[model samples]
Target: MQSFRTEIENPVVERDIIELEKKISLFRTGQIDEEKFRSLRLARGIYGQRQPGVQMIRIKLPYGKVTSEQLHRICKVSDEYSTGRLHITTRQDIQIHYVSLDRTPALWAELDKDDVTIREACGNTVRNITASETAGVDPREPFDVTPYADAAFRYMLRNPVGQEMGRKFKISFSSSEEDTALSYLHDLGFIAQIREENGTKVRGFKVLLGGGLGSQPRHADVVYEFLPTDQLIPFIEAVVRVFDRHGERAKRMKARMKFLISGIGLEAFMQLVEEEKTALPFKTYPIDHETYEKAQTLPNPPSVEVAEPTDESYLKWRKTNVFPQKQPGFYTLGIRVPLGDFRTDVARKLADLVKTYANNEIRFTLRQNIIIRDVKESLIAFFYQELKKLNMAAFGYNTTGDITACPGTDTCNLGIASSTGAAVVLEELIANEYPQYLYNSDLTIKISGCMNACGQHNMASIGFQGMSIKAGKLVLPALQVLLGGATLGGGQGIFADKVIKIPSKRGPEALRALLDDYEEHAQAEEAFHEYYQRLGQMYFYELLKPLSSTDNLAPYDFVDWGNEEEYVKAIGVGECAGVVIDLVATLLLEAEEKLSLAQESLAEKKWSDGIYHTYAAMVNAAKAILTSESINTNSYASIISSFDEHLVSSGKVSLGSTLSDIVYQIKTNEPTEAFAQNYLEDARRVFSGINAFREKEVNA
Candidate 1:
């Protein structure tokens, strides 16, 4: 294996890259097991793709903020290590697909030069932190949530409590009550708020928790109607700590925070979080607003003869795709990049455009669009013309025509159908026939290749989740149509109701029928969600029932969109790396890895880190032993108790004390160097005992 070179000045980042390079070598040689290696790589934002022999690298961009330099760096990295295409995810992260696994360390090192990261962008860690793109410029926002969002991202990135979780956790910050960030469906959400108390104004947030969208979608509950801004990080850290201990692990489908809250009740979860306050590093984590409040605007460009746009299309574009900022004489332009798919060449052009005309920074939106801020009022037409050259000046920025979609069958392993394909079909349908709908902000159309809702289809006014329907003896590509979903503002939203299933070929027609019915029968100025509620689910079901027919289906019905070949049936149960692992050896290897980390932390005199590493080592070893006996190890909590019951009680293993007593010392003891050293030694002793028992079992 060749050594990867990194010029990163930070010791932490250099070590991280070196560790990844080392793990890649070990994994290639089969020295490290697949499951353990998967987790390690995922923490560094390396994810498996539908295509074999390659990876999908998610470049973490906090709040979707990207400077021109970073954008250029990303494009260069994409061209060098992957296909020359940049894919923007709904989470505000950029994904470059078909990257060689061996080149990832070098690719990461390149990105680091521009201060961009891929760390914690994938896997069961806290994913990228997202915020409303309009956060800083929103006229109605209490304050810019960018700094707060930035603080949250900084605190959680590689934080011990969030590094390895039961499942990926999502967080969001809404700029205003409009909740443009869609706080309703996040694991934890913060809505900017301010209140007058005794002649003084206080900054705070309306915090929502336990919300998620997947096979089962749940709206977040307001954990705090008003929580002081200073307490935000501490509260979230406590919650994450509680989740780390109690969240589900064995069942991937049931491992989200929503499931934990649903299973144990929100009150119980909150109580557990309250108990974790003692272990948190901070009682108050105040965000210094100056970090983002300093200067977010660029100087106005020099005077130029900007011709007035005479084209009717340009007028329509300005109406829907442009907005005035709270800052006087400035505006933000929304660039609708269809399906969030843009080539690297265009991305470089966009970077140059931003630097030349608008602010050097552009935000990738949650709607899978780009928002360019601080454009002078006079340069609107000029900006529009420049954007047109890149083929990105579409009229509907967040309207019905701008569909949000995940990279379905194109690259995602979990994709059941071609979401991007269906999205293109739907976009054309709207643009050609319903051009008037471009101004309709009340309507949202989203598509997901599967029920996981990566496309966030469940939260759209008209939603399509990828599915396949059995037609007699033949299986055909299909979509499950859902209706009535909408964000009601103030962190309130509705999850769409499932209406019916139809062939993917007829998705456009089904959409036509639904829109036509709403146009004909809805009351004056009726919102989509309101109209759906007024008319009820059964009404829309009957209207779309005609398109749901399987009779007299053509050959085209079996073939999905954006494919030349006939579509084979797919249930979207994409391959999981965990299931393919040799669980026993993988568990042992993970234990050894944790022990290594413990020693490294102790050597650095980091008591808390060393203690935590030791705790993780003990848990890992116990889990390996429990897995050997085929016991239920659903979570870290389960592993500890099961180790005592299946091994200690059975006399299959002994240390003269229960494994519970040995591990639980982490919670009771102070995180001093002496205690950390003792814990590390205990973990080493346990690892030896487990390995010796494994040897004896093999001999037998």
Candidate 2:
């Protein structure tokens, strides 16, 4: 760790690594509580894998854009510190597996050298902000959203408001009304929009709020039809503040922003957002697009004529994997990476390939694939030949053959079965038997190792979730077949209905049955989504119900896919979100930490951050006192109200009127310099009064 210390040029990031090193030492020595230490490391993007002792390090790539140099840097880090294997997630982030937990800091230090980050990649923070992979190249998009997406990522990277929350908050930016980023399924989604105002073209977004996908997926509601791009950042900040204050803290399953919106309808949540506007630091946060929208240098292809490949496979590959960009004379080539896994050797070569044949950049798509943009037309054949050498010239880019899946039981602790393994089988089945389905974009297939839907099985036209069934006394691995899910576009989508469960080995047979029925009876004009709705869920269930029969289970039915051993179900604890610690001492220590942070923010004159820190400090202080009396508080709002009823109303602690008045003053006043200082002073006073009351109670 000390060896890499001097290598990291950024002082703040270097300090963060040093702090993590110290905390790891303390944790190993049992000086720090396990749960507390977990929270600290999670916020830093280090996660524990199912395999004991090692970790899965999620490398943060903003909007999935990677410069050639950055890609090579990631490959180097993976080769040295991890298994040399890189996996792309559904959220457009890359993950490396089986890394030693102790070496994470060194790995992070190496990544920092290239300006890539893993901070806030996991554990209850604003996750990697995603956008349409085709943002800059798509023909139908109004304007590229690269700048706005970059702005959101930069502003919220380590912002105090989103540092901790009841659950994760996901944000996305779509390039156009096509909503290729799947804006309808994010906590906050921004679809790029342009309107002519006073004869000037104005850029804005159709904002969608509170959408999420897990076991129960919810479509996001439109927060604004056309919000000027300037208001995007401020609006998101205020919404996060509200979520941090009132979102559920105890029940892990119901802690997402979608639940909060559902519990208190969208109108009520919007009202709360309105109430938080004055406290926001900026009224309109403008993002500069000069750099983000700049065009790349056009490549000069070889002047000599080159023979084009005559292979039939190359034609199929060309048709599905290449897109003519809106920019004349340039094309974007999509690489269908099977199962989102590729060795570092391929990655290094691919990195060099892009720099040589196209622009020095690439974008990782939401479907877990890579897209190389701005390629010269003359270089298409050269790229095809080069990709053929690397065996990365697969035809289907985002079609049925290009199946999307999470790394289910392979590494994820929450995985009940092998999602990736099943994905491999399904992809082979499509390429070998159902070859006609290769270019069929309407027929989507996605699988999850479990119901958490990391694979986004809930939103696929044909989805499968990992499950287990009891057959006599033995437990057999199963897949819950689902149907009818589709993204309706323009901020609309439908979640699949669970059709039936079949033995894991019988999954292939079930797919065959579903397809056979669809091919024979479906109208030629009907897409998969239309056919599914026309046929209904129960109809498909009955069509495939024969595969669900357990009476004929074979010996292979007990084993999960890609596993040789007999499957014994073992699901480990999920650390997707941190559990709120209930200890009074811990709460007090957290309060003091917040106070220290408050001082730092005050010194920086970040009034909004400082004020929020002070507010959190006072609430934590009140909770500490309440805990001393054996009273427990759930949410931040309840903590304030209970303090008033138990201490302020009883005259044990005085703030002139009520604790609510003291704690809730942030809403009444803007986050000005004067108000920030005054609020900090009031927090100091309230903190002191709470300590005094606690001492008195202890003495009695």
Candidate 3:
């Protein structure tokens, strides 16, 4: 038998309570080795998010399903080690924040005790497997995909081939027609399908491959109309193996499976998978259909005892947010969790409610939403009340579908602006200004702070990215708009074409104008994306000419910024920036509390005024670093330095400066920008350490 020690060889093992206490003492005494410290930190699930000092630890719930015990553990971990909050990701994963490196490993061990694994959560490997949360309960599903999802997860866990894929791989299974799994955008997508073979129903899947969305979005190709369920695992293994052998390993951007599918043509790739499948040395074990059936029949939900409701509000919710199940009088409720954010307390409450009303089950949707399956008619009222108390009773569904915003400047290291804050503001604007149209159209507006596209902006009906420009020696915040991307079922794809550029502050107005045009000119029953595409760019351009024009420019002179020679020909590449907080008083107070607890020295008297002043101070510091004689010596470093210099010369600081400061000024009199500069310097130091380490290993 394998020793339990071997099974827990990772930092999770060292994070045992006793070991953790010893490590904490070492860290407190400054005796910890830096490299080991970093490894242990990572092993414990603590990640240096996009912000300096603030960590985001991803808690992996295998198969996207967690027991009540696990949920409670997660809640406790977040409350004790993080920001007392949790974020439910689109991949059905949960992320907690503010965990320190010293506390990470212990937290992971705690999670391990509850059967959670955080391995490969962020690295260049197969990511969390996604499936229709309501897989077994939804009646519309031909077969439950939960078994397939679980089998795939076990088959791929720590598999050598998957340990180092060219890029992250995403796989999802949808057993229903509603497409709640967002299969169209995954690297690999499997949809349950059935066909009568000699009067017998044979279960299989329609396979999709290489679909992805970022700056260059593409829909998945339906390479195979049907593949037997038993052959599914081997077929997927073949596809991934092919990619492992031939996929580009040098160009990071071009390494995605989508690029491979595009380079090798769908027919050729499918042929290669078939050939490889024949020679594969392994086959997946048969699914235990009996066990699954028994699990499926565990218990029925309580029936509703009240009379059917006649209220329009409830009726609207039922129509838009509920999906029919194969079982009579049972339904799956799709609860929209706007922006994919929820508090830990709320999460616990939800877990309890699910236990009571949803047959002890819940599923997460790709849209950063949740679903309570097996809900009965009688329990609707109780479920409704609980959901309302948690502020999750909104019936938006596909109507005014919440803005999908990446954790831009707030936490991600690669943001150009505050995408989350911007999204919240834009959502509010839409709610207030266009309340009547909220339920009228299936419109999705997504925003990314930068081009990395964590928000999946490229696939939305409307999309925007944070940007900036130099205007008479001043850097002005701006946004780039994309239009007409909407994919219905099948492999039908539409790319979100660039429309115009405008001040970031004016995003709401721009959206309003675009929506107005859609409302006025759309043909009957036309989807917004379809309408925009059918109308062609010219008509919409003409309609939006007023908004596109610069101050004092005639309509004819207003050229689309996207079409400009510089933007058109320029390579769309940029580095990620560190995290930034909105400098509000409450946030400042929180920061102060953290600093005090850390026993860091700081002047707190002028905190309010100092915050605004920091922006300018950071700009100057950046200028000094960029113009330094040493920075100009290295060509690669010089390029980055020069860009910073340009921003500074234009009287601006790169937004990333907020998280890149080194030797942060703790005095309230010091500019907030100075602290940002210190953060940037710290980032450089870390990079230097990494480079030096790489060089030493190479020499050795």
lDDT of 1: 0.86
Q: Provide the TM-score for each candidate, comma-separated.
A: 0.96, 0.97, 0.72
lDDT of 3 by residue, 436-529 (tens): 5557547788888777677777777888886664444444456778888775754455668877776665667788888888778889989888
| Model 1 ranges off by over 4 Å | 1-6, 295-298, 570-582, 603-605, 669-675
lDDT of 1 by residue, 482-506 (tens): 9999999999999999999999999
| Candidate 2 structure quality by residue, lDDT tens digits, 489-586 | 79888888999999889889988888888899899888788899998988988898889899987888888999999998999988876565656666
Residue pair clashes in candidate 2: none
- Residue 390 of model 1, lDDT score: 88
For model 3, what is the C-alpha lDDT against the true structure? 0.62
After superposition, the stretches of candidate 2 with alpha carbons farther than 4 Å from their true spots are: 301-305, 626-632, 651-657, 693-700
Model 2 has an lDDT value of 0.88
lDDT-wise, the better of 1 and 2 is 2
